[model samples]
Target chain A: MRGDVQMRTMESSYSTKEVTKVPGWHGLVAWDLLFNNLTTGLFLFAAVGELALPGLLAPVAKAAYPVALVFLLTDLMLLVLDLGDPLRFHHMLRVFKPSSPMSLGTWSLTAYSLPLTLIVAIEAAQALNLLPAGSIVLEWVRKLAVVVGFLPAFGSLAYKGVLFSTSSQPGWKDARWLGGFVANSALMLGCAEMLAMSVLSGHSKAAASLRTVLMLLLLLNIIPAGLLFAEFHNTLSRLYRERQVYLALVLPFVGGTLIPLILLLVGDSAPGILGAVSLILLGSLAIRSLIIKIPHASREK
Target chain B: MVIRELELAGLPQASDPPIGPLSALLRRLTWPFRRGRAPQPHPATGFYTDTTVCIGCKACEVACKQWNQLAADGLNWSGNSYDNTAELSATSWRHVKFIEQFAANGRPTYPDHADSGAPSREVTLDQLLSGGGADRWLMMSDVCKHCVAAPCQHACPTGAIIYNEFANVYIQRDICNGCSYCIAACPFGVITRSDFDGHSHKCTLCYDRQRDGLVPACAKACPTASIQFGPVDELRDRARKRIEELHARGVPEAYLYGDEPGETYSELHSFYLLIDRPAIYGLPEAPFNPWLHLIGDYMRTIVSGLATVAAILAVLFLQGS
Candidate 1:
């Protein structure tokens, strides 16, 4: 039942009556569902946000395509392991259930990911001028790509928090802040992309605009996290109680939220510039790290 | 201990067929466990583990494995302790915990002892490694307590898991969506998702056996009568008497695990009478339900719902403007 150690990043304990038996194989199915929803959901949301507001972004949003496609492939591979036939993944698509997180997540990924992939391919083709720009078809495709790419990225990012929140686990049940966490994480991620593109494009007006978005994002991300930490501390559950809270709350808050917020507020001076980018990047890393280590019931021995 | 099995007047007494209206009225008031009657907590269920009488036979383990038909897990030696099977798992439902500690100060080997033992004969490092005079070796077969207010059932998302008519937590495999919410919610880390089926599973308190009017496999196979099972009320009295006897015999640490109704989960149906602090056996010092987090969940859900609506409305208003 220790599904994986990933579930137990925080300390917790409880007493219950243990059931001795059931008729079947070991519980691989549950692990698959959890892992798939988590991994795919994260990618979908990240992709959506990146694609949604490209004109306002630095160096455009072309690179997010390749990043998202890679995640799409990773998710597909993970999905293949969940069934007897990987080809039958389309079966999940035959019907849709809005109330079902998995169904919603699966359909969202399928719907958003394919168009986004095509858009990225077209963008790449145009960037290299492989597609003749004067052609009406090419122009139309570019316009469509620009319009359609944000849905999956935002959807994927936001769905995971909802998915986790709806779960019966006491730890997850209180996670109303999780949706905001995902949104903030997406903004942080978006900022990182903007920063990279700005550096590549040099100090243009676009770069300055990118900096503005990044700065605004820094604020958007920090406040909710501080609130989350305050709320997590208030939890009466045994799992939430810790003598000195570590990775799950404090580390993510400090490394991911506070540091970046501080840097962005200081207005991108030399140290601030370097620190802002690094802290934002580090924050994303911490966000993902906290996600992996946040202790589910399965991890406890 | 009073057994006042109230015999109320009812219709259809064998001696007198076709009973009257007064008999029916009397019978209606007799059944205390019926609807509209306030439930006095069923005389607090508990376990009377006579560890001193335990032979460490491990029949309980075998019985559990056979009844549950759990796959053999971690067959290889773990080297952490004598427990190659390490701890409880989705595959291994019953675990036998072996604790090695000092038994000096003439402390009785019982779970009730709030204080850990005083230092026994201190051996040199070499002697200690050689297993020289290792004072106390505690063997406990740990299982779920069937807590009065079971946390796992409360935490399950798909409603796949539930407390049955027997008041034991049972997982309905078909309904489980494999969300693993119950896994994180369980404070004890007792309920786990089986890696194979993708559904959470745990000890059922031998629901099948209970229906057949038989004890759980562990209790039935306990050669030393260490893992006794039955009506919880009767068990508590037996545990109290045994603890008193142990104290008289100079074993002061003979306390009960999950037995107290107030400090812990109200009462443990499968509660244990132990001879040492719970921590020594990997039990929490004090365990409480995680349901209290629901208040936060409720407030946050409402606030977030309002916030989302406000954000959407603001966007719409701005677009109109």
Candidate 2:
């Protein structure tokens, strides 16, 4: 919707200080950022499922990796398609620049795919009964997912936030709470996904447990979210005063999070939990798809 | 290794080393580039724009466009004096800003483009006749700053943006994947992604012309020698002398912008001399590089991730209980 934002001519000389939107970093960039975070959330879910609740949520554990793998691969394809030269996306692998968050992100993204794929392979082999019941390969893959996979999954969660903050864009410059906010939101996103899966599989116990964790996460996420809002309080007040912005950002996020959080806190029924998780999922998607646009949107006038 | 081979009189041996047939074929194919002549080091070069002398004829802009073969922007009435080119873009690298400080009735005004849909230049006969409410009309030809530590270079993921031998920030056209990170990272709003090719582009400081032992096209075509091109050190020295001369001549308001190392950003290699603050010329007063906060950003990420890990562990413990 914001794609038509023009690099408009200076209306007046005095307006130059606050105007001039840099063209590029369009909607596709926002979509990529959102998908990358979602994929990492799935990775975190699978990693935790395998390590902590193998017996209780073993089926959900088995399903999470493949879903994560699919999401990750799709996100990678979207990222390449978002580039100016899709065919030369491999050029990102040419160097290892720690100073550049994008450089580090590209490398970490590639590294993350390996352990995820390995876990998916082990899951596939087990599904086909290609190995014995107590196979060492199965155990090793699960353990590796915890040890090796955690690093990149966490890296994925963090890198996008670092990437945004380490740019000259105005809304992003003061994003001290961005990493925490994204990680916490994605954690809630992960719980919502797992809750849906467990509830569908008729694991009321797992669903209840996931619901409790989601409640805690929902409360925890407020710290970073509130801080992030406060960080932009001075710079973004003018932009936020518009009715469209309030409707687009504030209404959905507040309603999505608060309503579900309240429901989870008081209610324990399957239908209620399912409905709440749905709201959480929608809330995260709504916010993420528009978050990266804030910096550019501020200069639209 | 190549130098040692040449010094030891083993150049032939280095080129045709004893190897398997497959290895030999690979070696032969790569030998030319491996033994290529080393490049000569050159001094860091950039422009020293003294806006006081700018006539706003836009000869440098035309020269830049012609030499770079950049696509022309369609004619659009800017309503901001004679600055019709508007701003720098993927195509228009050199933009001459015409700051019309005076308006009709001598209001000392930069009149807002009113609710009227059409853009208007508000000069009236009264102010012109009375010679009242007159303010300085500042004209500056702005280009890429080519900062000593370029934020765009640091933000490029593909290693496409690199400093050439002259220490000018050069974008490798073939290597850039048009990620557009460089666009957002440039504090001066210099780089822009082209809709035509989907690649971000800015002034190369005429790396091609400099390689051929020629001055940048803009500097060469400048009518008033406003855009001076030379070694950065030489330009700084000249700027200091010019500043002293201006102050002596009672033009005390004149000072250099981007000439000295800034608190938040490095000294701009392509610096400027202006009579007013940088904000008046549409330049940031204190442009900050993202590099300054890069470490803090990463630390926040790691700390957030660690907090997440702890949260996850706590949840797991609660479930077990």
Candidate 3:
């Protein structure tokens, strides 16, 4: 009986055709990446600027900080809305698993928000004269906020890249350079945001300084973005061949890198600077969306 | 009034019965308060799916759906051979794959090598039934691997995906925040988000049945004993013996997948005995663990961040001087 069963089932077969499956990540995830990078990027830029050149760029840093906080809050709301069970989001903070990027991100976001909120509140109080001017205690608190905020801001900025690189999707896994790419892009976006704020507020000196900073950041961003594109080209030629990939490259190169570089070279004018900043911001979002689209694009025929 | 009083006099009053010493002892031993210690972990159990014996009946699939109370994935032909349901999804936990290959005059038609001067050969119905050619059909029922170090568990922000006492990966639906991180993390592409509820869903490895000392519905319903359920170690040994038997009988391609911890992750509790390369069955040849490659990436990010800070400080100092 066993022999009969074995014989009946032992047929050999061969199939040379391979099957490719699409990734499950959707549009919400793409939006999450965009918001996360933007929020963290702006805060880090402002905090670093304030810490590094406290006296020279105080007004720009102060203006950028509150704006960054608003974006951060919006990003948090977006994250919650993205959850399938939004009510159970608290479970994310209930446990901390060092091995899990998602867990780390949740804790980092929560920790980062605390100092950020304090900085925003204190700055607002000082601006409104609720806190006495030139108080040593207020100065100390401000210094402490900057120190406490920097670590989490930096972690939050890079966590999205780590999250993407850790996924099993072939397009995402092969592009390990994405972490650095995202971090640099975040910095560029932050700089562009500050530039926009300075230009709009008619802070000419601040705007010029921001323009120079934005140019340097934009140039730095190209290194990682170019490396990521090259890696994608080598590993996922099919996706690299798609029109969307070219668009992704061009949007960042022309809008983010080239146009911004040209505008900075031509000297800072209010309108021209505004145009470049707006383009960089749009390019930042487009590039992130494209990164999310790569794996899905590869799944097509 | 006199008749009612007479009838009442004939009735006896009810009283509580005394508890026996044995009954009292039993009650004390089984008391909820006394059972406060953590439940002992169940032995690791798993399914050993021997794909060589599957007959494409889809009995396992039906049984799993019925037992789990899963909704039908609709009857839509996918035009991919006899695979109507296609790949595994949120609603369809068990998927039976049918791979039909044809040969003419004992030579296989190489469709993949169409441009390489390989002749296109077709086998008719009569030729296949008469067994004059090398035509054959391969059927395998696919399910979640229930990996020891499950990436879904690692990727879950809410710790919703966890290892049960039976050593199976389980997703706690109530705890899941629907971040879909696990969907990306899963190398096997097993887990999927439900359209209606938006939470990730995958095979739970029949934890409830295992706790009740019963075999999973799929294993119980398998007609040819292709899906065998037992202790993972025992299943591994059985799979090894079966592979050896197949080798001795001239079937050399038989091998076990996810039976041992490779470079990617850990051993899978539910593994497979496959005759073809893993990719043929839609499995990655070399799976990667995200956690494994994270440290180097983190270090690089830290170093680059520090370098940027230093550069900024130097620029500031130069400007000031």
Candidate 4:
């Protein structure tokens, strides 16, 4: 998108001063951004479930699993649909090391998920009362699920950094800086789900707290995103590429960061909360997409 | 006193051997950056790709395949240029890029001079070599820069890739899970995932050869000594002299690629001598790691976090009112 902005857009949203202001984009833009986050979060969550429970809850897990599985699986299919082979995937795991994120993620998935499967198994067992309700195993499994389930949940949330931080690409490698990006993104994404649940359940403080966390994350991503842009520009010191970074990273910071921040600060009503929540979700999606789309060359010498 | 002395006589003390195999293994696994009392500082291994003497021979490509036992590319052309193996791929770790420029000076060689004029001298490579000429051809052999601050290394969650004592980037074959972050992180567009095996592959700087006191296979194979392999300092000195010689002979465009001393890297190990802009040879002029800008992103997150906290507080207050 930033690349396309460079190629297509003629208007100067980016300026050459210490402070360059950008015009606001429309509602559709924000809507599109939120949609992407919702989609990614929901999809990744489902993948976590599949790897966690394969057969124990057969019909329910089977019927419901594909909803998330199909979405998660489709992205890979899309990558291959563009006239590329998909069979080469197995090689990703053949000689796996613990140092690589993909390797770690694969292992993390395996470790976090096996227990999740057990949880489902235990749940099925409980539903069937195959074991007594007061049995030690049943009590232990329930306790374990509450504790262990968060592994895959939180792991899925935080794994984006592992993917981005490892890229030798200019946009992804800022290992020191990306923690907030991932944290805020995950927090907001999680908060949005909680917010939707809140709205459905009645505007409870839990939902409100989630919205508050989401807004905080959205605003939190902005300042450093700006500073990072300045640093990125200073580092690159090239017009052609720096312009692209500014457009993708900084432009969204306004609609995604500032506007939403302003809305939150000025209005504390339900509409205001919804508006801010919606914007942060949107901005996060754009940021994530931009992070992924940019191409960078290797820096290791 | 005599009895005490006898008791301690021959029995080895618990702390007698602190530097045993277990300790040694523990140190190596844990102290990645520490260089304690050791034999010589590890050999500073690196690649020296001297593009000046290159004849555009694809022998390096062939040798890489033979040594790595890579799958054949089956001779397909992209038709856009003379390039057969279009770009770097998962399988092909080494690729020679070909750029065809009609104007040798990289722009309209003679802005006003065109076909409207009478018969122009056929400016060929031989003629340009013979005497002063306006047009010239540029050829560069591209490979991984083997960056000192490799984002790929920093980003590897599993620690699959690491820099050797010699500072050569190494990917442990047993560990790489083929995330392709290295492939994407590489600014030089060098690293690629092998289609056959998914794991990311790139020039090892011939780490294996350097370990055995030999030059990289590509550098060794170059008949013209085009790819000089040696200590980076010595190579830099030689490269400087060669550039000076080219300048003395009036090839003003001759400059070293990836050799800026104070740049992001402390003078690239696999730096090149180029007769064109780095970008013309497909290098980012002022490349940077995105991680550097993360500080700003962190700030933004903090501000955003505060705002979130404040907003929640404000909402709670409003509800109370």
lDDT of 1 by residue, B1-321 (tens): 221111222234688666579986565434321234322332232345666666667787778878877766746775434566666666666677665553334443232231345333334566445433324556777777677776666544334565666666677653554545456545455665666655566777777877776788888898888887877777878888888998897666688776667653556777776765566566765766545444453345335433432442343233333
Between candidates 2 and 4, which one is better according to TM-score?
2
TM-scores for every candidate against the unseen true structure: 0.55, 0.86, 0.86, 0.59
List each candidate's DockQ score: 0.04, 0.29, 0.23, 0.10
Q: Which prediction has the highest TM-score against the true structure?
A: 2
Candidate 2 structure quality by residue, lDDT tens digits, B126-245: 744543232455789999999989999999988889888898898977678789888878878888887767788899999999999999999999989999999999999999999999
lDDT at position A46, candidate 3: 75
Error of 2 at B119 (Å): 23
Listed per model in order, the count of residue pairs whose N, CA or C atoms clash below 3 Å is 51, 0, 0, 46
| Ranking of predictions according to DockQ | 2, 3, 4, 1
Write down the DockQ of candidate 2. 0.29
Interface RMSD for each predicted structure: 12.7, 8.7, 7.0, 13.0
Residue B13 lDDT, candidate 1, scale 0-100? 62
- Expressed as tens digits, the lDDT of each residue in A1-301 for candidate 3 is 1122223333222122212234455676677777777778777877777787777667777787788788788788878877776755676875788677778888888888998888888888988999886889987898798789888888887777888788777677777678878777777777788778878887776676777677777777777777888877744556465675567677678976798789777977887888887777777777777778776765553
Candidate 4 colliding pairs, count: 46
Residue B309, model 3, lDDT = 56
Model 4: per-residue Cα lDDT over B25-110, one tens digit each: 66545443333453355756566676767776877777776665566776896652545775555456666656544442233233
Q: lDDT for each of the candidates?
A: 0.54, 0.77, 0.75, 0.53
True lDDT of residue A159, candidate 3:
77
